[model samples]
Target: MWISPAFHLKVIRAYDALVTQQPHPGAIDIRDPKQLAIVALQLVEVNRDLQAKVDTMQVAVDAHHRIAKASAGSRCVTDAAKDLQVRPKDLFSWLSANRWIYRRPGGSGWLAYQDRIQAGLLEHKVHTVERPDGTDKVVENLLVTPKGLAKLAVAFRTPNAA
Candidate 1:
């Protein structure tokens, strides 16, 4: 149920697009918002596809971690590997292919998808504060407002439903 805020906003925007579509008499029949509808569905489908993969891996990881914990002296990654029996590289490949995770060389996949969601939630406004010691500072999480959600929802909703 841990839906990324970005995808949620995307869905909301898709819904909004459908709701606010104006009839283009010359481009298409006023009775049908074909182009708008098609775009909306595509956005929703992309979100769904990515979400399914994230959910699938999370479930497998969770199961593996649980068993590892019960057995004692098990690290999260070790348990995850055991439960899923997938090589780290392969797992990264899977996550990367879905665009929900990015490869990090020696480290496990980075949660770029989560970062995107956080950025979107913050109203597309982000500030990078650098320290005097030449160290990079962390950015605050973006908050997804109702308006953003509405926009994505409209963009993704079926055209006929509008």
Candidate 2:
């Protein structure tokens, strides 16, 4: 719908009266569609530039947070695998080779060193499974941390980029 400049001015005046707004804009009234179109184009360009800046800032913030977390130490493997779109076992295999996770003494499973673990990608969980005879047993599992995720990210992304 085409809004006459007079009507637009009246509406603005009414709004100003209602709000008692201060420091009113000094731009002249837009009487022609061509003028409105030009203003619209300028506004669109300004909005696009603003949005682009916001996107850049957001990316920078995300990188900062990720770096902070990655160096903080501590995260699970399974969740990290999910983030990297790989299997937990496969990730663990890579982690073992990378020395992020180490085997415990006396035939026990691996243990994540407290100092080495980075940002937590997932939490360790205990699951109860029922056997055929109606007996339930508990199983505990751990996942890779942020540092591990960072390692996986670098190792996986670098080769694929080529």
Candidate 3:
């Protein structure tokens, strides 16, 4: 159902040409039945082409949805990086540069930005670690949500994506 911008431009140009009584490449002469039939046939061909493109796009979208659904849980940065086909360090750098994650003021672990967590792109899980003194410390781990993984896949595949 997506109409391309080029198709809209062609329609507008053809309309203007007809209203101005000017001969344009896309303009069809209604006075000639043969020309009108030819234009109708051309339109059928264009419709078929557009439908094919729509079908292809739908398939890609469906595949992405399936992948996102199958994951269905937050994953560590390393696993997400592997799924994205990027180095874990590079992925961490990219996430930091993109403002999706950051290191705490004096902490080594990464933390998700408030906006990213609010947007359901990132999440945090608390882990309890026992120290040598028999004391437990809570550690917060930043993980990427399934939705975030799908978005990252698209962003990584796009040319010139930040």
Please give each candidate's TM-score: 0.23, 0.36, 0.62
TM-score of 2: 0.36
Highest-scoring model, TM-score: 3
Off by over 4 Å in 2: 1-90, 105-110, 116-122, 145-148, 159-162
Candidate 1 residues lying further than 4 Å off, grouped into runs, are 1-32, 74-162
Q: Which lDDT tens digits does candidate 3 get at residues 32-97?
A: 899989989999999999999997676547536545544668899898887666789989999999
Ranking by TM-score: 3, 2, 1
lDDT of 2 by residue, 66-149 (tens): 445443544456655655556788888887786666777784666655555444433355689999899998765666556455
Quality of model 1 by C-alpha lDDT: 0.48
Best of the two (1, 3) by TM-score? 3
Score residue 115 of candidate 1 by CA lDDT: 55
Report residue 2 deviation for candidate 3 (angstroms). 47
What stretches of model 3 exceed 4 Å from their correct place? Answer: 1-34, 37-70, 158-162
Cα lDDT of model 1 by residue, 120-156, tens digit: 4113334688999999876532232333223222322
Q: By lDDT, highest first, what's the ranking? A: 3, 2, 1
Higher-lDDT candidate among 1 and 3?
3
Considering every candidate listed, which one attains the maximal lDDT? 3
